[model samples]
Target: MTDSRRSSISSIKSDVKSDIESPELPLDQKHFGNTLDQKAQAQSKEQPSEETPSTIPNGGLVAWLQVLSGFMCFMSAWGMVNGFGVFQDFYSSTLIPDVSNSDISWIGSIQAFLLCSATVFAGPIYDHGHPRLLVMFGSVLVVFGMMMTSLCSEYWQLMLAQGLCVGFGAGCLFLPSIAIIPSYFTTKKAVAMGIAASGSSFGGVIFPIIFRRLEPRIGFGWATRAIGFISLTSLLIPCFCIKARAFPKTRRKLLDFAAFKEPAYALFSLASFVGFVGLYVPFFYISTYAKDVSGLEDTLSFYMLPIMSAGSIAGRIIPGLVADKVGALNVLGVCNLCASILGFCWIAIHHTAGGLIVWALLYGALSGAFVSLQPTTVASIT
Candidate 1:
């Protein structure tokens, strides 16, 4: 099946290349062919086009603006997810204290699942041209989800509001951000992506502090509303600024399994799936772990998130710079290895505050590094 798929993709690429090189076509077709040829020649002179791909745009003002838009989109969408620790703690203790950790875990797991899985369809949609509508719809869904979540009390209600609705909204918003970046940066792609991806870290830093402060005075409902307001603001900036530059007018199939034909991409995608499986387990469980194992005070357990977020800030920024220099795959490999080791270390720290703190710092750092580098790794493989 894999070989047949590869052959199909290769045949498609060859046909496209032949069409671009053909001479008996119309004037417009000939002009497009010439443009494609120049692009191919330029790609060959510098690096492997297969590795870099044509989706990347050379850096420019509009390109950087798109990156800025992507940053805002990421910050709002993923930042909310990062801030889940706050929500998890609140809900588990106040509304659903009797709920088992494993059961409550599904709320976050579903959110993360939807957020990641949404990309499968969202990518092709962006390629088809309607990023503006997709983002607008996403923003509306997210705001609505938060507003509705404020009124819910049951487990299913929370899951519907926080897990599925917010997750679906985030998926809609975030897919465009990831897919659109490749449209904007070719040479400075890594650096540009690094800067944009920092939005999540920035959100990590800001949302926790904001939610922590609000939870005391406003209560969970209003605290969430406050966070929702922040998300609203971040999402709006991108809706106005981001755009596709000379995008192709081609139709996109809903599913493009052809992407898996690339062995490197397939491997990286598999690794990504493995890495994400363990990823949210820590994010969701860390606070409970702190409270349960370390016997830490509630306030201290809460503070662990900010500490993790703090390390993540550094983790997101530095590895991005390094990925640009060394190579994204190498950085991702190391980050995953570090995360696996840290997970084991976390398992051992079942009864100590210091050990929990150490785990938080290590896991936080690795998480940032992993997220930041993954895009670059995808860029490298594609």
Candidate 2:
């Protein structure tokens, strides 16, 4: 009986060994019973691999073209927005003469506000890899709004045409202009941004001069139409030239409320909110202020906005250079402090064009620095 039991156990062990060594079985040395070689081959076939480069191509023709495109975006969006002082004057005197200065101020304020506020929606759309589409649509809205503004004699019409339409359009263009640069650059980011931001300063100078120069010859309606044509031409560069380097693999929220939980982000956001509220006050009102308080002629008062914008061109570029060295946040802090002081100093410059000019130039420089460095500063902390 013992002999028969031993023979039966041996036969069962032999059967188990054969099953383990069988060629048809899926099990292998790999974990979870995966056949190592076959699994690897299957993965290779299913999803092709891409090698990530070690370094960003910080300086190249393509990168610089992006910068140029960003520059033109700023020129068309913020440049036109900054030049609203011209409109503020025009609307008060010629178009909507019955409206109070406070009511007229709302038009420019809304334009500036929506230019920034629309980014909440724009940023998410931009992230999903549709930059050219957004820019093309924005360009159309901007030109259309400007043309519509030309024909508007009433307050509500101007608000719809310029404030809501142009502001939302500018918002669409603004995020992609600044956001794409960081993907292409690392060390030279601040300077690149500064250069791109200086486009607004240039626009600030050119738009006012354009409106001021042509308004008399062409009349307000034609003058505005001419400005619209110029905007259409300028906006085309961004629509064609700008391209993004990378896109996120996963989706993100339109508003990243989690970022606000960090103290630095919260404070910085609050400070920016407070700072910008008053910053554009000078840009929008400086011309009107010059006319009211400084007794400057209408022609001379209009030039103040352009001069301020011109100073900002230097402000944007130079601060960016300095920021890359000393750190963007540090430079931004100094600029903000100086800008605050300059804001108060505006009160003291009464009845002198030269004083107002100097004030405007200094204020413009400091404000421009703040504008250019702001994004860089946020990038560092975040």
TM-scores of all predicted structures: 0.82, 0.87
Q: In candidate 2, what are the lDDT values of residues 1-382, reduced to their tens digit?
A: 6999999999999998988897454444334455676788896765434324445788799999999998988988898878988899888888889998889888878988888888888877887778888889889988999999999889999999999998888888888899888777888999999999999999899988998899889898899998899989998899999998776655479886777898998899999999888888888888888998889998899899999999899999999999999999999999889989988888888778899999999989999987788889998997
Worst 10 residues of 1 by lDDT: 46-55
Structure candidate 2, residue pairs in collision: none
Screening candidate 1 with a backbone cut-off below 3 angstroms (N, C-alpha, C), the clashing residue pairs are none
Number of the top candidate by lDDT? 2
Worst 10 contiguous positions by lDDT, candidate 2: 46-55
Query: Which candidate has the top score in TM-score?
Result: 2
On a 0 to 100 scale, what is the lDDT of residue 72 in model 1?
Answer: 88
Q: For model 2, what is the error of residue 184's alpha carbon versus the real structure, in angstroms, after optimal superposition?
A: 1.0
- Model 1, residue 202: displacement in angstroms? 2.6
Candidate 1 overall lDDT versus native? 0.79
lDDT of 1 by residue, 1-382 (tens): 6999999999999998988896367889889989999999985654423424465557767788888898888787777777677778777888788887678878878888898898788777776678898899889888888888888888999899989999998899887776677666665666677677777767766887887898789887888788788888878988898786544445558887887999989988888888788786766666766787778998888888877866776777777778777887888788888888887777687787887787788788888877777777887778
Candidate 1 vs. true structure, TM-score = 0.82
